[model samples]
Target: MVSDTLKAVMQKEGVVAIVAQGKAFPHVVNTWHSYVSVGNDSFIVPVGGMHGMEEALNHDNRVLVTVGSKEVEGLHGMGTGFLLSGHAKMISDGEEYALMKKNYPWARAIMNITILNAIQTV
Candidate 1:
């Protein structure tokens, strides 16, 4: 489950980095906080041109999502970040996909992530 503090940080303006397991090396992609829709323990990200991420997910769907917010207070400071371990899958159709597409007209698919663990880090 996700904590309220973590959810608050996620809603603020920041960069979200998703690391996917690649064949040679780990492939990383960037999205923004505005591009995500949060659930109780999951995230729905609109996919535009993340071909590399999509390819990597073809082999392994495990991902590490890094998110931060300067507006939120950390353990020792005014900013905070979290490293989220989750399972992801690309969805092209369904209710979630419809919602994403309605907001992001250019989106070709949606990356659905089910969070397994979340750790706060400064």
Candidate 2:
């Protein structure tokens, strides 16, 4: 399960940058908005900016997401969460996009990510 604080951060503006391991080191991709799946699983559906981000997703699927409440004090309130491993795919179909658009009104666009692992930190 995701902490309330983390979820709140995700809902805000700006983008979440995910880092994945590559042949040499790591690659990064930024998403304007993300749809987090329920339960303990670590999955994220990153929405918006699909062009270049798709390339980064291809290199590596593993990702780490950072979200927090700046208002809160200490690292406990501002920490990072890990989505150890997962896959990323472009939501090219119009139907899929439409559904996501309907479901997530706040999101300009959407991507579906299946979580393989989820880790919480304080």
Candidate 3:
């Protein structure tokens, strides 16, 4: 689930890393915090491009995402972050994709992530 503070962090400009499993090494992709749309237990990403995402998802749909913003107030300072664990799937057409496309006209797909766990580290 998403918290109020975390939602605030998402609204600010920041880096978001999406880590996925591959056959040899773990694959990592970067997206902006502003690119993420948060729900109660889900997050939808308008995928402009993520080269190995589909291939990696084919092996394992599980994903780890790290999102943070220095502009948001944290537990100790002016930075806040969360590590999110979820299952992801890429969809090219659907209501979700349509919604995402409305926001990001350049998006080629939608990565719908269902959150399994979310931990605040700062």
Best by TM-score: 1
Candidate 3 lDDT by residue in tens digits, 1-122 = 88888899889988889889987889898888788898998888888778687789889999999998888889999998999999999999988899889989999998988989989899
**Residue lDDT tens for model 2, 1-122:** 44554555555544555665666666676655345543344444536655455566667655565443344333455534433345555565577667666766655554555555444444
Residue 113 error, candidate 2, Å: 1.8
lDDT of 2 at 89: 59
Stretches of model 2 off by over 4 angstroms after superposition: 3-5, 21-25, 33-50, 72-85, 101-109
Q: Candidate 1, after superposition: displacement of residue 37 in Å?
A: 0.3
Q: Which whole-number lDDT from 0 to 100 does residue 41 have in model 1?
A: 92
Q: Each candidate's TM vs. the true structure?
A: 0.97, 0.54, 0.94
lDDT of 3 at 46: 83
How do all the candidates rank in terms of lDDT, highest first?
Answer: 1, 3, 2
lDDT of 1 by residue, 39-116 (tens): 999999999999999999998999999999989989888989999999999999999799889999999999999999
Model 2: worst 10 consecutive residues (lDDT sum): 66-75
Model 1, runs deviating above 4 Å:
none
Q: In model 3, what are the clashing residue pairs, if there are any?
A: none
Candidate 3 local accuracy as lDDT?
Answer: 0.89
Candidate 3 structure, TM-score to reference: 0.94
